[model samples]
Target: MEDGKLTVRAVERALDILLCFTDSSDLSLTEIASRVSLHKSTVHRLLASLEGKGFVIRDASSDKYRLGFRIWELSANMTHSDDPALILLPEMERLRDQLDETISLYVSDGLERVRVQAVQSNQAIRRVAPIGARMPLHVGASSKILVAFAEPEVQQSLLASPAWPAGLDKASFRQQLAEAKSLGFATSVEEREPGAAAVAVPILNRAHRLVAALAVSGPSNRLTLEKMMEHAPVLMEAARRMGKMIK
Candidate 1:
């Protein structure tokens, strides 16, 4: 292989390894190898390289790999430049107050959705999601909205996975996505979290491509399925307004 091509291949593989951290907080060498579709030795070699650069490190307590401080630093800096989280913060707060539920903003990362910003619900008994929570693309309302509006390949890859991840089943997830597409919105009722339900709508950019998802989540007892359906239009409107403000 040519030198430049070889370098690109290595870079891609390294990035693949880093991507494994999206859904996993810690994983062993064998687990990382399986997730990344690489041999154990290859994973070890790449991990050594990353560890040297302070991007990844093995947990001394559990011997599992976790992203390192250096990686967090880089991600923080990149977030500042992209400014997606910051741009959406004001709107998220508004949505949270209007619905009195957790409001979250998520962006696609490969086949997963990463929570970039989250506002906690004010109600005493409410659903709470942290800022860095990672969710499967097909599970919750927010994630599905993000996936439904994404490139076809991105949605197809998640459907084609041989084994579905936690909080989602393959066949049911496909059916849900189809419905979400038809409705031009997404919803989940007691699917992702127990006693929790949500409605989500896709945010699009000037190019009419998916940029993010805006979601409102609360306890199912309070945010009934009927009420969620009622609020679907509200979520869509917020998504549209946020999309316009994004770029």
Candidate 2:
């Protein structure tokens, strides 16, 4: 067989070994080799590779292997909304206290944006993006910011989607998304709710992937264009701090 074909066959066998643990978490080297119909020597080498990369660990006493911390970490982050909110809430509060405005953190759920964390302003009339609030991705500063910072394939699929607001101009929306990304922030005045204004920035992960949108919103009279622009830098910085805190 060609070297490339041998490599592919080896990978397939390695993956088969991994799948054996799906139904059972722990297995001996002999047991795994039997399950995958592979020789003991090849199975041992594959298990060593998996263990070296922290995908699996072999117990010296029991002579059995089980999944490792890397697998747990990946599973935990599969639901991005959970652990990240816990880490980001404190930073959101700090930004709210610093700016004296409503703070919100939203993550994309398919074509909709879900508010996972928020700190409402104590003022008499403030815009409230309540926790668990779900909004379409085609409108609002936070929504636009989330979609704009989304992965390229995701952004293209979302933009080409037909669920956008009626009479929405795709070209202008694309231009606005580009501007928002270039400027590192996005703003909307009375777009989502009447008498409401907001400025949003992207909350990214360690890989620089957009996980959420951090926004400060308030009554239009108080959060005017100039104020949102002035506070954009602060919001951007807060998002950066929150991203660093995400494990």
What is the C-alpha local distance difference test score of each model? 0.84, 0.86
Point out where model 1 deviates above 4 Å.
1-81, 165-172
* Candidate 2 vs. true structure, TM-score: 0.66
In angstroms, how far off is 58's CA in candidate 2? Answer: 52
Task: Write model 2 residue lDDT over 18-103, tens digit each, in one string.
Answer: 77875576999999989998889989999999899898999999999998887888877675654777778778888888999999
| Candidate 2 least-lDDT 10 residues | 75-84
lDDT of 1 by residue, 158-189 (tens): 77776566655677767877888899788788
Best by TM-score: 1
Pairs of residues clashing in candidate 2:
none
lDDT of 2: 0.86
Query: Compared to the true structure, candidate 1 yields what TM-score?
Result: 0.68
